[model samples]
Target: MKTREISKRKCIGCGEMKPKKELIRIVKNKEGEVSIDKVGKKPGRGAYVCNSLECLEKGMKSRRVERSFKMKIEQEIYDKLKEEIVNE
Candidate 1:
């Protein structure tokens, strides 16, 4: 019998390694549209974060997601992330 492997992604917010399903995904597409990607199927650069508001705050304060994606993250993206975190 073979054990299935769980895909792991590092959380940009808290610097923790979490399974894909356990974290929320934020994607920046080639067109430069940044949004919270709950489905994780969006095509483009992606950042992983936990579901907690604390994680989102930490990420926003430190710009960890910006570091991960190698691009300047706009305030609107942070707003969307906060909105998604709250909805979750």
Candidate 2:
């Protein structure tokens, strides 16, 4: 039997490489809207982060998401992401 390989992505916050399924994806759509891609199927540029407040805060403090998406992110989007992370 053959085993499939798992995809990995770097966490923008902690700068660690982790399995894609284990990280949270933040996507920016073509319309320039940003949101959390819970299913990881959203079409757009995506940035990964760990599922923790520390990672989230680090990402925010460093503005990694903004850099990855090449645009300014609203505080509301970050707030929404934080809420989702906490709820999860």
Candidate 3:
């Protein structure tokens, strides 16, 4: 029998390794648009973060997302991502 390999990604905020599906993905598309990728299928470069607010806050405060994406992250994008995390 063959075992399936699970995908793993590091959280930009907490610096923890977790299953890809267990983390939220933020993507920057070819058009230079940044957005939360809930489905993880967006066509772009993706950064992962935990679903917790603490992690989200840390990521924002420390500019982890900005560093990962190599671009400035708008406050509204962070707010929207936080709302989604909190609601989940």
Give the winner by TM-score.
2
Model 3 residue 71 lDDT score: 90
lDDT for each residue of candidate 2 in 1-88, tens digit (9 for 90 to 100): 9999999999999999999999999999999999889999999999999999899899999998899999998899899999999999
- The best candidate by lDDT is 2
Which residue pairs collide, candidate 2? none
The TM-score that candidate 1 achieves is 0.91
Query: Which residue segments of model 3 deviate by more than 4 Å?
Result: none
State how far residue 84 of model 3 sits from its true place (Å). Answer: 1.3
Model 3: worst 10 consecutive residues (lDDT sum): 72-81
Candidate 1 on 1-88: residue-level lDDT in tens? 9999999998877889989999998888999778888788989988888999898889888988888778887787788778878988
TM-scores for all predictions = 0.91, 0.95, 0.93
Model 2, position 22, has a per-residue lDDT of: 96
By lDDT, is 1 or 3 better?
Answer: 3
